[model samples]
Structures are given as structure tokens and as C-alpha cells.
Target: MNGLTNVSRRSTQLLRRSLHTSAALRDAAPAGQTLRRTGLYDLHKENGATMVGFAGFDMPLKYEGSTPVESHHHVRKEAGLFDVGHMVQSMFRGPTAAQFLEHLTPSSLATGLKPYQSTLSVLLNPTGGIIDDTVITKHTESSFYVVTNAGRRDVDLPWFEQKLKEWNTTELAKKEGGVEMEVMEDWGLVALQGPKAAAHLQSLTSHDLTTIPFGRSAFISVSSSSSSSAADTHLLHVARGGYTGEDGFEISLPPSTTTLLTQLLLSSSPTVQLAGLAARDSLRLEAGMCLYGNDLDETTSPVEAGLSWVIGKERRSEGAGFVGESEILRQLKEGVERRRVGVVSEGAPARQGAKLVDLKTEEEIGTITSGIPSPTLGKNVAMGYINARTHEGLHRKGSEVGVVVRGKMRKGVVTPMPFVKPNYFRG
Candidate 1:
């Protein structure tokens, strides 16, 4: 059978057996709870998207005309637009804003991050477990913009609010400057991703796209052709980074200008088609990016998740004293019981919760957290955790293991990831 046909048949079988629960299903809106809609809800519906409940919101799973595999491949080879407006955006300001943020996350925000630069960070509990993964940008020394996962709103928002109140009332904050946070409600965020993204986006604005290197951001004016009473141009906050491991930009702007901006991006090139959650999932997985509820949670530590790079060198030496620093430092110095790793398996594709066993003993050692048939690699790729002791000896590339799929053992090997090389535009 062809790749698409094989994938379709396996997906059907997996769905029928309920072998793996989706991240969307895991975080679906509670019964009797109303689902929220992003600013682009009408546009998504107009485009014939398949809507599903995700993170307490009605989100498009995929466009009706495109399969997940097709959308995934399209984004890898060309460019694709994704509506990610459901994510929470907030602005923190005040003289003590940087200091306040420094105490909340493990990243060296106060020392390492420069103005207009962004860093991927994790909110931590006091015990050093992850609260949520977030992208924080330093707009200024005293001003910041943060974007966090939509599914983490319930936990993240309350934590930020409580911390802000506490920090504002603290003696040090009073001696310095107090901090305040503003949630950017009803805003819009769209990700334009792939190899050709920069060339297409450069045509929309006068700003030299080449100067805004990876992990940096800029505010650029976007000209629109939509001849409504609305302004002919609008300023948007565009960041040069994305989850897809591609050269891309994530544009954030007011709700009123979202549809026009999206239209402009789509019309920029023939390759820029609309993508949705299904494609987003597979792309991120191939990029080795973690999905919050699936690959990370309140119980997981950054060191164990292979995110140790997020901890700054200065923080490690000077003990930056962020929340969970003690346990995190301990883990960094000693080691974790298990470490997350990538896997490539033969036979059927392993799904989340599939048992990973030792090939020789057939003993369960770990479980698959995320898995998919990669469009870029044309192989079954997965991310999971293996016992650190076993990982040291047997988790190298080409080391054979067993992944239990529907009670059958499938041959698999521990492999290095991003399964596909990342095409980030660093320059």
C-alpha cells in the first residue's frame, strides 16, 4: 500500500481500538462548559475546517480538503499558515518586571535575554516540576511579552496573577518598582512556517527581514489590500521563531486586523496554504518539540525532558535562585531516573502510552509519550522516556528495543532527533 493509504488504515485501526488518546481529547472542554472561539473562528469555518474542542476552545483540526500528512509535508517543503490565536498572550510592565519574571522561571531572563529577543522557558513549581512551557520576549528591560499554551491558561494565569500580587506587595518590589500584568484578550496570532517563509513575509513589510534573526522579534507595519473602512496598514508584533523547526515567523496583532493579515499571507505565495491542529501536532513531533500535556506536565522536570539547555550557564553557577532551583540543580548535578529520547520503530507506529520494553528481557522500561508516521522521514517516529541506566547502555542510535503496539512487540531503535534537520534562520 502507498504511504497515505497505510497511514489511513493504521489510523482507523488505532481509533477503533482507542490505542492512543489525542492531546486535544485529553484537554477537551469539560461537559456543560462553553467552548471559546478565537478571532479567526468565522474565517476557519468559511474555509471548511474540521472544528474540534481543544483546550476549552473550538479549534480547527484540519482543513476539509487536506489530509494531516499532506499538510505536514506542505509545511516542510514550502510554507503554511496556522491559526494559533487560542494561545494566551500577556504583557508585563513596570520597573521590576524583569526581576519578577526572573523569580518565576528557570531561564536567565534578567541577565541573558536582550531587548526584542525571545527565549523558551518553563514555569516551575516550588518542587522543580514544570508548570508550563512558555515563550517570553523582552520588549524592554521593564516591559515584556509572554505567550503560553492555551491548555495551560487555567494554571498559568492564576499563577501569574497570584505572583504579581505578591511581588507588587513585597518590600523589594516597593523599594524597586512594582510590576503589573495585562492580558491581551481577543488578540490574534498566526504562524507562517517553512523554508520559503522569510521570502514571502519580506514582501509584506518594509522592515529588513534578514536583520531579525532567529529568537528575535520586531514590530512591523503590515499593508493590507482589503478595502474596508479599517486602516490600510496595521502594526504587528512579529517574532522570528516557531515550533515547526522551520524558518518562520509568528505574527501577533489586534483582532480587527487578523483576517486581512491572514489573507495577505495566504496570497503572498501559492505554497502558503492553511494548516490546522492535526498538521501542527505531527510537525511539532517531527521537530522534537514537546506537547505540554503529552510530553510534559507538572510532574516532569526540564533536565529529564532534555531541556537542560534552557537553563543558563550563569544560573547554574550562581544559583539564579528561581523557583525549583534546588531540585533542578540537584537533578542537573546528579541525574534523572529516566530521560526523554527519540525512537524509530519497524512494523506499526507506536502511539502514546505504548509500552517500551527491553528487547532481550521483554520487560517494560518506559512508555511512548508521542508518536506518528513522519511525512518528512517516511518512518514511524516517537518520543518517550527510558530508564537512565538502560538509556546509557542501550539508548544509542541503532540500539534495538521493542515497542508494544496493541499487545504485539514491534522492533524499534533509539534514534537521535529532530528526525529531520531544523531549518531555523539564525541569521
Candidate 2:
């Protein structure tokens, strides 16, 4: 075998050995109450991960030897893998499923989105508030795969249950088989992200990675480079999109093979380190992607979050019969009172709940929703909502502003979002 393949084999061997220990597996879960554990819990601990509780799961926040910023920069320059299995994954399948789901969001899932394509959409409440931001993938006309933030699980699950019951009980249920919601509990989801991510992952599968462009997906068989596991290929649902705004793939596979698959990905020549939640937060913020609880909530609407594009063009014109069509349409025509925007400041990094003031008047006009010291730009980058009525036309790009950090006003500007330019692969 070639030297590169040999290195991969050895890496996989080490991973398998480290992951099989019962002590690590047992200790990975918290002692008192039952927090959730992904299939890779033991493997994360084996790699010297710093564990933290998030969204009711024991998750790795960062790994030894790499700070969150270091991991963030690595993902931008090369590649990194993230365990995102804690997020809720679910399937909506049965006849008329598309019609049923379309009632929950303004996305044109039943018509506009092609089979195998995905869209970043929001779950809307009756008042046009965002219930959650979710990625919805159409497997067929009647089968869809959805992923939503784990932090919103308490809210999302009940919404799904109630809505599913309403739709399944309607007349549509008698003519076509009612839609069924099946939670993919314990399924494994990982993102292989960065510029080199595609090339790195290409070595494992015979499927032409090029065919799966951004927002598209395909089921492909992948095997570890190790000779012992080469023949045991596992089928994975690979979607070519990510929260980081980098060109990447989110692979979903059975829980049983989560560790093996992760090891297999890490075993690629030149290697990609395992990144955790902290790095992911900064990366996604740099990418200008919204974190459900931070940048969005039941009190916010997609329009106010600068995600109006998520509303389908045709759906809008036709008055999409979705949950909050009236309120959203009113906002679309008349405009929102406040809108989400990017802010870059000259002082300390702004964190959530930071107040924003008009620099000239020293009047509070907005609030920071998310922020970080951008590793790529070396600046304090933030996302926030600024009220138009409070400071008319003052939140436009380059408008002078002051972000209140630690009770001190720091000079800043209303910078256009995606603090870092996106590198999403269109091809």
C-alpha cells in the first residue's frame, strides 16, 4: 500500500482502539442527571476533548493543544470536522408530507425546491415570529429531512407534535396518507468543512463529489482507508452545505458507525483536527449564519433577521398559506421596524445583550444578538438588530455607532453582514 494510505490505516487503528474503552464511554455522560450523548461521545473524550453541557448533551467545547481561535483559523485555511449530532434530525414522510410542511414555513418546498436540494428555512409562528431556523432537504416529493437547533428542542418538538396532529387530522389525511414525523434520535451528523473539505472527502467515496453542488445531497457509500474496514462501506446521506458558510458537506449516518466514520474522515492524508462547539460558534458568526437562540427566537421574524430571502419568491406572491403569511407579507411590503445587521467595533468584542447607541447622540437604539473577536479579521465582529424608528437610516452600512461593551462605549460601524466573505462553492 502507498505511504498515504498506510498513514490513514494507522490513524483509523488508533481511533478504534481508543474508542473501545468502557471507562471513557461510561464517564462521557454526566453523573447526576441524564444529558444526551451522541454516538461519538467516547471518541471525543479519547481525543482529549474538553467536554461541556450544551443543549442537553455532553459535547466537546474544544480540544487540548488548540484554542478556539486556533481551531477557527484552521477551518478557514484548511479543513476541520465537527460533531453536530446533538441537533435534532427528523424525517417527514408519507403522502402529502410536502403540503403539510409547507403550512409550517413559507419555503416553497412542494414546488420550487428540487428533489435532493435543501434550503435554510424558518419555522414561523402565527404572528410571524420565528419558531426556529432549520435546514430542510427534499428527498422526494413526499419525504423530507429536517435539522433544527438542539437548543430549541423543547420548543420545536412540541410545535412539531401539535402541527402534525392538526394536519394529519384534516381532510387531507383521508385522501392521501397523513404525514408522519419520525425523529432520527441518536443519529449521527458531522460537518467536514473548509476549502479543502471536498478534496479530502473525495478520496473515500467512488461517487463523484462534484455532482453534489451546494444545497444538494446524495446518498453515497464510504469506507475507511484502513485495509480491515475497506470492504465494509456504509451508506451516508451527504448534503453539500454547512452553517459555517464554507464549502463543505454535512454527512448523516447510522448511530452505530458514527465513530468509525469520524475516524475515517480524520484519517485523510494531511489530517483534519476535531473542532468543538466554541470554534463552531465563532466560525458560524464570521460566516454571518444565525444561531437560533442568539440571533433568532419566537419574538423575531425572518425579515427582521435579514433572512427574508428564505421566503420563496413564488410563495410570497401567491400569499403562501403558511403559518404567518399575513404578518410576514405586511412586513415585506411595509418593512420591519428593526432589522438585523453586522457591526464591527474598535474595542472589546461585544457579547449578546450588549446595547447599541448612536455615537453622535449617545442614545440607545439597538441590541447585540451575537458577537466575537473574529480570528480571521482580528476585529470585534457582531450581529445585532437596530430599530429604524429609533434612529432612522442610521443603521445603514458605514453609519457611525457605539457598541456598549463592559459599560464603555466603543466606536463601531454598521458593517454589512457576512463579516468575512463567504467561500461557498457554487459548482
* C-alpha lDDT score of every prediction, in listed order: 0.86, 0.84
User: Please, what is the TM-score per model?
Assistant: 0.94, 0.90
Segments of candidate 1 deviating more than 4 angstroms: 1-20, 226-230, 317-319, 390-392
Where's the lowest-lDDT run of ten residues in candidate 1? 11-20
For model 1, how many clashes? 0
Q: Mind giving the per-residue lDDT tens digits that candidate 1 earns over 270-341?
A: 879999887888889889999888889888999989999898888885458688999999999888888888
Candidate with best lDDT: 1
TM-score of 1: 0.94
Write candidate 2's Cα lDDT for 1-427 as tens digits: 5985564444333222222221223244445767788899998999899887676678887788776667777899899999999989999999989988889999889888899999999999999999888999999998999999886787899999999988988887878889989999889999999999999999988899999999999999887654547468788999998978789999997888888888889988565889887778778888898876677888999999889998888888645689999999999998888989999998776777889998888999999888776767867788989998668987798898899988999998999978889888888
